[model samples]
Target: MMITKEQRSLYRSEGYMILPGVIPPAMLAMLREECSYYLGYYDCIMDSRGVQTENISHRGKRYFINNRYRLSSRLWQFIFSDLMAEVARATVGDEAWLMHEQWVVKGAEQGMKFAWHQDSGYVKWYNPTTQHKPYVTCWCTLDEVSEENGTVYLLPHSRGGTKSEIITHIKEDGTNDLIGYTGSDPGDPVVVPAGSIVAFDSFVFHRSGPNLTGNMRRIYLPQYSEKPLTRPDGKPWAMATPFLKDGKNIYNHAEDSAENWGPFPEDKNVVV
Candidate 1:
């Protein structure tokens, strides 16, 4: 769990950072009590009542995956939970891999918002300085995040800036509407507390809103790469399609489970 050299120069000149408690309160109390027992019996983590099923979660939030190599494997111990692949092998170096996993639920009141964009425009298909220029993601939180409860509003470095730049749009009675973007603004309600951990740059530029504090923020997203990278249209960025495997259909991150097993430890006794 050591990624320091000024946090790898703030993850290569400010794309993201917030490490905080690199996760250990008994593995965050067993993944926050298995995410409150699956957000109370299959609300599928967070569907509050917007009912939509095939579960990959964006609005209904429920995307855990860990196919085989099991053991209460909720997305395989939180995407191979070894202190987030030891900070993704020190900011994406030692052949980092994982590939995908996301949980983001927001309940307290739940209004569902997210729309700013840039998770490599939905998991970049390829090309950005020769094959997805160093992917990296980690959100963590799992509760205690805030902006009155709908935290995470980022923009950090906006990965090489300018996909046209300028974006704000919050409407639906939350009004913000600015629209446009390429980079700049990676901040706002970056609260992050309950076991913090942010680490971004999948082309940054985030978004999120609507919770109005009652309790319930949950976060867990994960995505790491370097495993023989290739994209920029060369293919093999790892989603060869099977509708993108893992807990079957919906929100592909190579279907979670630390992208098919490779990062768990905080539980079977601390030994690295």
Candidate 2:
């Protein structure tokens, strides 16, 4: 199995696990290439709009490019691969859906720090009444990450509180980041190789430091849910593309439809 018993135990209790350098070298290369392409695409879009900042993104500093997997010729290979299936089965369940995907990047010395908040905090902010099981975030690293390069810090359930529920987050004024944890405990820093995947529960509290090094820190984050997550109105909050059913991959490239993926929730406070 991809995840060991000890690793699974840690995840069950702490809500996060680091699978060190698990991605194949060739697959990692492909993900990095796709990330570069998408980063350029985001810049081009920003240039066309004649704006330095879009939503939470600040030009040349930080970026959150989301849900553009259809544009990449090879991204589906990783998204629907055996590696991801194993991860989904481990963290989510036998049935899984692609809830969201994004390239979260921090550029060189200007990369800003991300605030501490659960992944579910964003969902709760958008749809307060909606309830769903905790999903899994496969934080696939495209570069070796450390505290110096904006690596994520995770707060375990024991320290951060219960993992079964979402905490209401307060929006920070300037950056539009949502804050959930304000206590003194410094979360556990993740320092791992380029191809590692840090899988965490959606309810886990996490944050990152600013990039202090002279190189960009890149991470391709793909989230999966036990089932399609919906708003109180019953509309999908994000992409709910089917990946696995009954412990088997049911994704069909030919049948994929961006139209059916549903509209990404409109968050005026944050950019897509």
Candidate 3:
């Protein structure tokens, strides 16, 4: 799985590019089946009528994260595998590190909607110039996702996805409305086929619409950092996180596997 020059160019120019069939079908199928294992422990909030419910999600569509690393090691195997890391490194640079690995599940007919935002803002603990300036997040689809099923809607080839791009409420659960995107209109919906991989910069303005289709959209998200995991103030990271440091899985420490970990500093009140 080499990241072609064209792919690299597309990414740099558009801030994102979908690599069609980048993942082998067999691997994709296996991951799709295995995705259930990651979400098995958590239950979505439901109404008395047995219908899914959510405060922000209209009909209860939501994504769950496997923070405990309790699933089969195969998941980690595929994530940390050299083949995948190479793709990330192609864009983020040789020193690219896998900063995070998790499965994102959008259940069938669950109307899940992700607000428009950027990973840069979430990990603002790291200064822009000192830390990894530009990062890439690879989103591998385990299921065929289309506009009908709420594929991602994003703005491409722009200096978007930053705090400045968002002009609406800037709270923990802020709508994160883009500079010009009104409630009635967002961006364009992207159709992602199964086994496809979408790599986008952390600053790309992107969000997915509500899934109204009758199938789940399961995506494996692997975040890549171009440099050593360190905060703006010279504090180390990932060493205390559950990420793959330099392509090696380090899940042996208690603090490394702790839950409820966030990116903001202790004194910051940006969000939980």
Candidate 4:
């Protein structure tokens, strides 16, 4: 989990870095299988075919709360395992806290497009200021991603830049909302074989395209933040859904500090 100096630069300038083969293949396979199982559960519970049918959006499909204990117990350790956390700490510095987990699955025929927007936009529903420190999103690829399979596309440094200032908000229609950015170029779509990990700034503008590959494209995105960087309104970090409480220790060590986490200037040389 040692990060190269180049990673630091890319994270600082582009707001993202792709670390391939960071997670083992076995764990990744299990994650995919378990996710599929959960999707079935979610579809069963939230299926919109009834009188008050649920209109689950492709982008909102991550809301399905599959069994947390089964999933978190194992994946949580894999995430905070010394190696993984070290990389996270280096880029984000100390005060990082486990934020939340999102399972993004797009079925071939039902796959949908996510409009380009900053992660912070959705985050603003609770936090509104730009003064807080940046948060990190560790997106783990469960299936091979490609142009046909709807790989994620990043807009370089879109977080701090004024170009393409699209924000995520709720429209009057009561649906997920999106704004457009006119001044930015689309960063290349990152295609990774299963087991690769991509870390990016929570503020970076990113979105996924349609899946024409005739298969499901699945990804596990877990967000984390350094301590003291509260939401804009000054709420605690635990307000985000799926957050664990202090000392609960439901999974992993469940506690971290600046000593165990901080920026590493040495490993930045390795190119992702």
Q: What TM-score goes with each of the models? A: 0.29, 0.95, 0.71, 0.74
Cα lDDT of candidate 2 equals 0.87
Candidate 4 per-residue lDDT over residues 140-222, each given as its tens digit: 88888887887888877744472334254443233243433434566579988888888987667776777776677888766
Regions more than 4 Å wrong, model 3? 44-60, 125-132, 159-169, 172-185, 231-272
Per-residue accuracy of model 2 over 12-54 as CA lDDT, tens digit each: 8989888999999999999989888989999998999999988
Residue 74 error, candidate 3, Å = 0.9
**Residue 151 local lDDT, model 4:** 85
Task: State how far residue 253 of model 3 sits from its true place (Å).
Answer: 14
Pairs clashing in candidate 3?
61-110
Off by over 4 Å in 4: 48-56, 59-72, 129-131, 158-177, 180-184, 228-272
Off by over 4 Å in 1: 1-3, 17-22, 32-34, 41-138, 141-166, 170-197, 200-204, 207-218, 221-272
lDDT of 1 by residue, 166-268 (tens): 2232222332222234345545557856877888766656676777765667776666666534555564443221221222222244454445645442110
Q: Estimate, for each residue in 100-146, the C-alpha lDDT of model 3 and write its tens digit.
A: 55666667886566766555544542343433465777888877878
How does residue 136 of candidate 2 score in lDDT?
Answer: 91
**True-structure lDDT of candidate 4:** 0.58
Ranking by TM-score, best first?
2, 4, 3, 1
TM-score comparison, 1 vs 2, better candidate: 2
